[model samples]
Target: MSFFDRFKNPKTAEEKKRIRQERLLLILSGVLLGISFPPFPFPFSLLAFVAFIPFLLVIERRETLLTLNKATYLMSFVFSLITLYWVGSWQPESDPFLMAGGIALLLAYPCVMLIASTLYYLSGKIFPKKINLWFFPVYWVLTEYLLTLTDIHFPWILLGHGQVKFLAFIQAADIIGTFGLSLVVFYINVFLYKAFSNYKNNNRYSVNYLVAGVSIFLLFVVYGLIRISSIELPNRKVRVGLIQPDINPWKKWGTGSLDKMVDDYLSLSQQAVDSGAQIIFWPETALPVYLMGGNYQNEVDKIYSFLEKNKVTLLSGMPDIQYYFNKEDAPADAKFNKSTNSYYTAYNALIELTPGTRNYKRYGKMKLVPLGEHVPFSEEFSFLADIFKWGVGLGGWNIGKDTLVFKVPVENNLGKDTISVSGLICFESVFPIFVAAFVQRGAEFIAVVTNDSWYGNSSGPYQHKDFAILRAVENRRSVVRAANGGISCIINPLGEIEAETKMFTKDVLVGDVVLNKEKTFYTEHPKIVTAIISIFSLWVVGINILLFIKKKFDL
Candidate 1:
């Protein structure tokens, strides 16, 4: 029968029953995947290993590309909605635009997932039946990698991230990175799905496939155990303090006076200092205003004074601005200021303020949150910036150009020494390779500053904190995260949480973080795994297209 014939005719009872089963299975797959995400607890994440089996079963039954993609969209749609429902900050005090953006993301993410399913369908058309099912992982990995390159990129739900709770299973990330873990997960799903299908058909090789899948999983577990048991962190440690002020996101922007906020942060830092903190870190936008914009000299002086008195370094997130009188000297996307008759750009930036030196280092945030920070493709379609801005004035920020590794000098009882650390401003921590670049450059440890209060006490904040575990494991670097309104914590090189702060509380955490001078295999060769998978995905597409050309022209 033709593909359209079944739809054109009335459905039979058996066919209707089969359709119902497929729908239920797809929904189950999505739910399993969603609940398997981080902050859900440990054994829950184990479901990720088998989450795709039901989805794959549906794919196997669908013969046409349209049917296959429709199933793909349905399953991924449920998955996206369940896991990313918190993106919009759907709270009474949340901005309407922020909520709207969140809804839009849930709707659009399924479409992005469809890219992989559609490519997999296309590959099945060219490859032999036995060889086609294995291409799903390559296509999915390629899609995830490609998302990192786009303007509206959000690789938030990369499959490997789900396995963070399985500490022993993920220690391999140091060598393969998250992408490799994702590959392992996908292949295991494929093997298990194949085994189940064969068993139902009474095939003899069912047990072989099941054993292969289980064996591969245990192999990684054993490797993780060995790495964790034998791994040695450096003796060199830096005593650091993280401050969570529990500030309300809405009030801090316009209503709160800059001086009062600075004072509050200083008071919190004083507490951390009293605990013997050599260096203090505050959450993102600790100072919402431009501290060095020449208008807030008093506030700047007060911060420097505190730094000098306490004999410590203060690193915090602040809004930074740059001005250009000549149009040629400004970037093409620089904003125009009519009052000043100049082009100026604003940044969501980080600054380092040390006690005795007036010279401070700054790093503008590079990986911006789309719609939340800046509109994607706003460079060409600048009007989108004005239309899609967040209600709290966080919607339009210029992308930073340079990657900076801050050199912090601290004095201990032994002597005065300098250490290098990478500062990730909010959403930048989610990018594995991006974080690795800082380690490759010279950063001995990772410090993240963020304000997740906009999302309130939702899964967004918790999930955001857990991703730091992967970064820590992948680079073998200790991570210190300071968040406004909670979940501030420190993670060691082994992906273990050393110290943590609860959500929605004003708190201070102090911990000694290890400083590693050596780079991990993943850090040194960040792109190797993803690059290889991308090439194979390209070959799949290239081969499929060539076969189509040959069949169409009889060549």
Candidate 2:
């Protein structure tokens, strides 16, 4: 039968009614999931608690595995389309064919959600009796955790991220990370589903399920309240300056005057320094040109001299190049220029220019945006680069191997103290564990440099900033974000925005940021929760495999 024929006419009247009900339920779940994210009118975060219940009900009632898979994929695809449609707004003028942007907005997240849903369904089937309701949360958490380990890592619509605006309930992230929040939300959905299912069949609800769900949710709220109240700002404060240049990403490389851009940055830096800013920050690729390249020596000298004269350290994002003697000696994924016959690696780096020193410390960006910065698995499948090269004009970049931290001298009331700053370049701020790793390695404050101009005035920048707040709460470190075209702000350890800038504005924000060194439970043991879930998931998969073999062979 054709694809539509199966859904167009059912075998019986009862089957037709069942299919209609299933469609409504799946659509309801998808809409609920979508509105839970930012840019939606209301922050109805409560919807997240029961968003997946409809899908769960659909899965449980499915007569065939193929039907279940198709239903799950449709639900997930709808959810992805609603929440991540802003991705399609990225450089549409450049991508007339919409191939690259389409993959990002339409294809990527749906595929991820489909994989997650499949695992969840499989886990349910494997432990039908013992783990009917419990497996969903575990499988979902495992799926999110594994996404972090991949090259095309996009954890934007993680269930926990939906609760960012509801700060009071998400403080548990400081201890357990966002995966824990996902577990909490999914468990509540499972409990509610069970309670309602029991009520439908027996005309009575399961008191245990209701109690468990309510109690766990209340526990998170209580913990959040206590945690927010307990946090005290550190005594040592660093006066940091953030510059938002509002450069148009499309014309930034070719059309705009390079000299004029540098002058604008210098003017802003001077304004920030005059306001008694101890350390100044610039957005990602603020310099526009490769600072390390020979062409920009005069511009580099100007910046260095300004830093030396003001006695203030300047941390700016710029493009960097590292040339290799031999193509084989370069990183496995390093791009080669056929024209230059040179092997080189390009980086979106944070350069720290200290007073009285030409020698600058650099932190190369590690977690790159999949197609924007580097195509995934381009090294293994070289043709993928040509296929996915539409949006940014730049090809795949070499991944940075080290987690480097810079020590900036901050003069506080007590004496001169040093604040260890960790750099998160552009999309790197979205990863929870990646930021936590820097904190564990002696980073006192996190600095994010990004250029969100490509997103325009869409929900993309807002969502990006929301992820940074979670990172701050997770690691209990203050975040200083510098975005090229807006939303630059300083977020406190309690997930509060201390200072901010509007989108598409050239502005300078100077704020007193508390330099904190104390690490949270999450920082000390970042992957402990994920490790436990992964181990259990593997065991469940093993059991499922054995059960399948036994049933197939008639054992």
Candidate 3:
């Protein structure tokens, strides 16, 4: 029968009722997961623990993988729409290409989710035992981790991100990372589903499942409390200033705005320096033009003059260009400049300038925002670049090859030393593994520079700010975030926000952030944790496939 024919008419009243209940359960699961995210109040995140139970119950009654996947896809779509609706920047000035990308993500993310459900369904069919449900966490977490490894990656809805408001509960991120938290949440939901199923069947053992689920939760909370209490932040500190210029992101790229933009940054840096700030941070793309690309020498001199006058180090996110004079030095994909007869590329990058240091340190942003910053598989299908260009000219940034740490000299009443810091530009902050890589490389603190103004007064900025909290906890390093329109703040090693600015406001946040040279267990051994999880996921799926082959082929 055709896929649509199955839904045309139910043969009996009981079947119709079951179908209606399944649809409601799927929607319920989606709504629970959606409202649990940021921009909602605290305690809402608790809903995430039980969110998957309803969906699992629906999966239990479905016999065919096709029907089960279809149900899972709709549930995922509802969740994605709620969490990622602001990605397209649906304003009057928004680029059509940007909007198109956003819509595509909402549609495609659900299809990606089908991988986990299919695994679960097949495992259950092969195992023919209730024990198969216990592997759901592994299947789900593997999918979340796999999403982080690709160019079209968007790990925005990782289950652990929902617990950002519950600080004490998330302290364990230092040891396990966000993906581990996802595993824990998924297990709890599976147990709860088991308890509910057993209770409906009048089994007294339902209490055991309930107790098992609650016990894991309580154990995690106890561990979190102990961890949060035992955390002793480093004594060394640096007073950093975050400049939120509140510039209209769309208008800044137009003609005659470069001078004013630089002036605004200098003016804000002066305020921070006057307040005794040793380091000043500017938001992403602070200078829309290439300030160091030979043509903007005058602007470069102005920035240098201000840094020298204040004796303060300035780290800002901006567009960086590199021209390869030698043909052999250029990558095959490098754009050719006909006027100069040279090959070059542009990057969304962070540059650090210190007083008396003519050579600035720079780190190009590695994780590009899918279609907004780059086209996925552009290298394999080169024509994609021609069709996916954004009107604002930010659609084609070359990926950065290296992760760099900035070394800044600091001096105060007690002593002087060079602090090692790593900068994450824009969406690079979302990947847990990516953030921890910098910590493993000896970064004492983390700096994030972003332009959240494009989305404007939405949950995107708020959610972006909160994700930094997990990074702080995971790496046990302070996170200092500077955004164009606000939510600029400092997050300590314990995932606490020290100071923050309001959205769409032009302001400066000056706060003392700790400099910690220590790395967390998660930072040191992320591979081990993810490897074990991946092994279990693959082991179960591999067994299921082998079993099916043996049964069908009589091998």
Candidate 4:
């Protein structure tokens, strides 16, 4: 029979009530889970684990033959709808319907979430009830592990992402990255689920759940204490300055506000210099015009000259546009490799200025944002350039090739150190691996330049800045973040905000913090920690397979 036919015309109202309960359980779980997204902040984060107990209990302990497939999909649907709401928030003006299509994708991806739930449920079904409790957490952790593939896999709302605000809880991030908290969150939920399911009937399960939960909580406490005590942060401070220009991008780029924008930055930088800053940083795309071009060569030289005379290292986020040709004047749509085969402008960027340096050195930003930096299918399906607004003259951005390092000789009251600095522009700071790459490549300090003006007064800037602080803590490196509309701050290697400027304010903060030459685990081997977790995940999968074989053969 068909799906609905199986449950249709139930002889008793009891059957209808059971179906209704299943639907409610799934939808509620999905919606509550979305709160686990960023902005809620942790140890308020532990609330998300509570959401899972009800949902998982309902899915695993169902008595009827009404398969969980439908409920799981609905749960996934509700989740993606709320969690990935930002995707639909940004729509191209040309096609308003594109927003709706983007929103639809959020629900469509619920299939994968449903599949994840299905695997976990299958493990519980095959194993003994007592053993299943342990496997439930393991299975869920494995599900989260596999959710890190490119394009398709979505790892956005992993439980730890919610802990962005809590420094102490997130200290674990330095050791195991965000995935560890995901496993812990689900492990707690699994124990709770069994506790609730076995309540009244056994009552014993609840005690076990409490014991396990308390144990995990204590372990995290011990972990935090150990990390804070054992890991002595090397004396790595920098005399840093952050300038917030408070310029509107639309008016600056599209209107006649160019002069005003330039004046805002120059004034901010001078103010920072007056405050005795040894290094000054400006926000992303700070320069309205190309400084290095032959036409503007004199201006670029002038900025360098001023910086040198001031004895300060000036880090500015400016776009360095370069024309690229396959041979000579190859058509704009010329192909390179299969991935990036479009002929257009490429970026020669991330320039650093030190007072008295002969010339400025630059590093182009790698790992560009999907639509904002370069259109995905523009190379394979090249028509996206002209037809759809992905052209150099308009919407498209040129990709940068190299990672820029800014070498500076920093001096303190006690002594001086030769420090190598690098920058992560805008969304580049959001990617842990990318920032870790810079640290591995001999960068002693991180300078994150972001323009959150487009994001407006939402929690966007705070959320973005919060993640940047994690990079600092994870690498034990000082981070200086310069933004267009404030939330500009200095983050120490321990993930503490040593100093911060107010949001949406025209402010310049200058302070003396050390920049060190010491090494950090996250800086040394980025993928190493994530790789160890990945291996543990594979072991969980292997155990599940072994158990399945034992069940099938009755061995």
Candidate 5:
């Protein structure tokens, strides 16, 4: 028998029925949590909220703390497992073991869930009088709010992500950020829980309860539909050429060579310019060649000349290097690296290259790709760090501490106008906070450069396309993405895909992207409000701790 079976006693039929229902809830929670991960449709998220209701209704009310704790762990485990399993599947054959190990360690969500569950459990006891029908919703909001502030945030498959497919309901994300939608989902789930619990307990239905349960929903549904339909994208003066360089990451890094890589991008960029393109963008690492000033000056000079001759400002990703210096040998606040072979640098970064112009900017990616970019803190799964066949840079990739915002002078029909745009390299598009920061820093338009060739030609690119839509909605900003190996798209603030290219195809996605100065709540200040909410939750936990301590003394 299982270990839990030994502790169990034979139950009567009534008790058996309750236990069965609880088990069903747990399984339902697991499936919903799994669906919340990508490679599935967004409408599936309604199931997550629906599933939470049964657990709240059927699980013993007194054991609410413990029951939810188990539920949290179970759901979190399923989520982390399904989401992170791509590590092993994508790993090169030689280092499959390392990929397997890294996948386990990087998945720290279960522990985070366990912590949140414990805090809420104590609140259930300490605030017993105030643990109203809204308690569960409040607790869930607190957890999500806390998750974003902490360093170990992997904001993939958020509740707001679930509405990427449903553009009408999601347009409000610009005002409240993705968290607002998440709050609504929790609100509905908690209301449903209260409804189910009340109905199951008695034969009579309370009209007061029904109104209390669904009133917010009715208001939200009405307001959401109205806002989505009423608002139209205001005209802004801006035009950009999204550079879609279809290059495979493996071949670009391997013996297959970067000759095609360099030629294809340069040729496409020239074409965009000839077609009256002002600002051109290339996908992440589209220029697979390493750029070290002076040393690779000859190679780097050619790219610079191309930009100036074409008279188009080119924002592209290349292999960027900085010198690594020992901390002891370097002065505090040193601007440049002074260690390796006459001024080598310590990091790899995404750099902005302007033709005929000496002024350029570089932004190191802040959130590195797990395993693919960097390893987790603990060495328990350190073996997983060694698995990238085409991946370079040892130890870890350098993280940019602040927002990498830049401006470029462009030639438009309106006149010689300067546009402010920020680059979100690869996975950063999925991170809402990062996107918000760039917007806050006067980035009128969001430009994302990605090399989706890592996942091959499959659902990976399609899934990423979903997030591109979310970025536009969540920030209330127009977004243009340049992807290597297809799915390059231009999305408007209203979550409309203006134009998109197909997967695994050599294609150009052309569209008119407008630049706007109209700021949304998320774009103005993304995490500042959420940070306040998270701080209040800590206070709630503190109060619960005091109650726990006082009770212990009384005993």
Candidate 6:
């Protein structure tokens, strides 16, 4: 039977009514989830609590595995579509119909959701009735952790991210990471669903589960309050200048005047320096050309000269190319050019140019944006690139291997010391584990340089900025975000937005970011939570397989 046959071939009026009700509930869940995100409709993040309740109700009502799977997919797809419509809007000129990008977005969010939902349903089938709810939350978190392991990672819409504005509630991320918060959210929805169902059936409500759920939530809030009150900004401070050039990325890509763009950035850097800025940060692709690719040495030297004359360190995003005589020596993902007769690797990198130093420290971006910066599975099927290519000259960038940290000299009232900095380019800021690894490697603070102009004036920029807050709270590190368009801001360790710029505006933001060497529980033991969950997931699978064997063989 075709996929749509179920809708058309309803045998009874009750079945038709049930299908209509399920569709409505699923869509409601999606909208509620979307509005719960940052830059919310009215800043009511508590909507997230009840957002999944409708979907849970639909799942409970499912009579078959197929129905449960369909309901889950519908809920997830609608939620992803509503909240992440900007995914399709990115680089529309390159993908006029938004097919390639749209399909990629579908795979990133909805398809992942389908997998999570399927796992959830399967886990429920394997577990006993009373303990099934617990399994779903754990399995959901496992699914989220699994996303981090893949190349096409989109950790943007994690449940903890929705609560970033509630600084007093989400500080627990420092201990257990964002997955812990997601676990809490799922438990709450399950509790509410149980309560509502019991009331409908005139049965005694599960007060024990309710108390346990409420206690967990209260603990998160109380722990957050204590942690927030105890956080101390380090004495050593770095006055960082964030430049939002407000250049339209599409237009910037097409423009020929590379010198003009470089001058624009330098002029802004000078403005920041005039205001006592010690370190200047420019957005991703601010130079638009490979600085070390040997073609733009003069322009690269011009920026270097400005940094030298002002005695300020500049951290800017630029394309970097490394040529290899042997293709075997290049990275596994490196692209080979037949015309050049050499294999080379390209990176979306953050370069640190300091005064009186010819050798600059370069940190290549590890998490390349799928379909936008790097095409997935291109190595296996190179023709997939021509089919999925969009945006002028965007795609097929090689991934970076190292978690490079740069040291910057700064002074405080106490004394002077070099601060270790972790520079995250573009979407790398969204990954909790990725940022924590840098902190574990002794990065005092985090700097995020991005080109969000591709998202235009949509909620994409706002949503992107919110992730920085979670990263700050999770790692207890100050985040300095410099976006090409707007939403540039400085986020303190407590998940507070100290300063920010409006979207689509040319602006310079200068703020003091405290340099701290303290590592939080999350940074020191990054994958502890996920690791524990993985072991339990394996145990669950093992038990299920053993039970199936026993039942099949009458053992």
- Model 2, runs deviating above 4 Å: 1-8, 41-43, 90-94, 97-99, 203-205, 327-329, 551-555
Number of the predicted model whose lDDT against the real structure is largest: 1
Instruction: Pick the winner on lDDT between candidates 1 and 3.
Output: 1
Candidate achieving higher lDDT, 1 or 5: 1
Task: Compute the lDDT of residue 330 as modeled in candidate 5.
Answer: 42
lDDT of the structure predicted as candidate 6? 0.81
Task: For each candidate in the order shown, give its overall lDDT on alpha carbons.
Answer: 0.90, 0.82, 0.88, 0.66, 0.66, 0.81
What candidate 5 gets wrong by more than 4 Å, as runs, is 1-21, 36-39, 42-45, 58-67, 79-87, 91-98, 105-107, 129-133, 149-151, 203-209, 292-294, 324-348, 377-395, 457-460, 552-555
Where model 4 places Cα greater than 4 Å from the true spot, the runs are 3-12, 36-38, 41-43, 61-73, 76-115, 118-156, 203-205, 229-231, 325-344, 385-395, 402-404, 528-555
Residue 238, candidate 6: alpha-carbon lDDT = 83
Candidate 4 residue 478 C-alpha distance from true site, Å? 2.7
Cα lDDT of model 3 by residue, 1-555, tens digit: 886886688888998898888999999999899888897767998999999999988877777888879889988999888988988889998888888888998899899888888888877865664777787688778888888987989998899998898887798898899999988888999888899999999999899999999999988889988988887887889898899999889888887567777898899889998888888999999988988765887788899999898888999998999999999999876877899999998889899988886898778888998889998889788899888888899988988889999988877435787888899998889999998899889999999999988987778999999989999999999999999998899999999888899999899999888989877889998776679978876777788889878989999
lDDT of 4 by residue, 164-249 (tens): 66666667766666666666777777766766766757776678877787688667768766776776665556677788888765
lDDT of 2 by residue, 148-237 (tens): 777778777888888888888899998889988888898899888887777777745577778878888899999999989988878878
| Candidate 6 lDDT tens digits, 301-361 | 8988998888889888988888987977977766778898888888889988888888888
In Å, residue 178's CA in model 4 sits off its true spot by 1.6
C-alpha lDDT (0 to 100) for residue 547 of candidate 5:
77
Evaluate model 3: give its lDDT: 0.88
Residue-wise C-alpha lDDT for candidate 1, range 1-555, written one tens digit per residue: 886785674468897888889999999999998889977999998899899999989987788788888898899888888789999998898998888888889888888888898888888877866778898888888788877886888989999998989999999999999999999998999999999999999999999999999999999999999999998888888899999999999888877877788889899999999999998998898877878875888888999999999899989988889899999999998999899999999999999998888888889999999888988999998888877867679888999888899998987544788989999999899899999999999999999999999888888999999988999999999999999987899999999998899999999999888989998999999899899988887887898889989999999
Residue 239 lDDT, candidate 1, scale 0-100: 90
Number of clashing residue pairs, candidate 1: 0
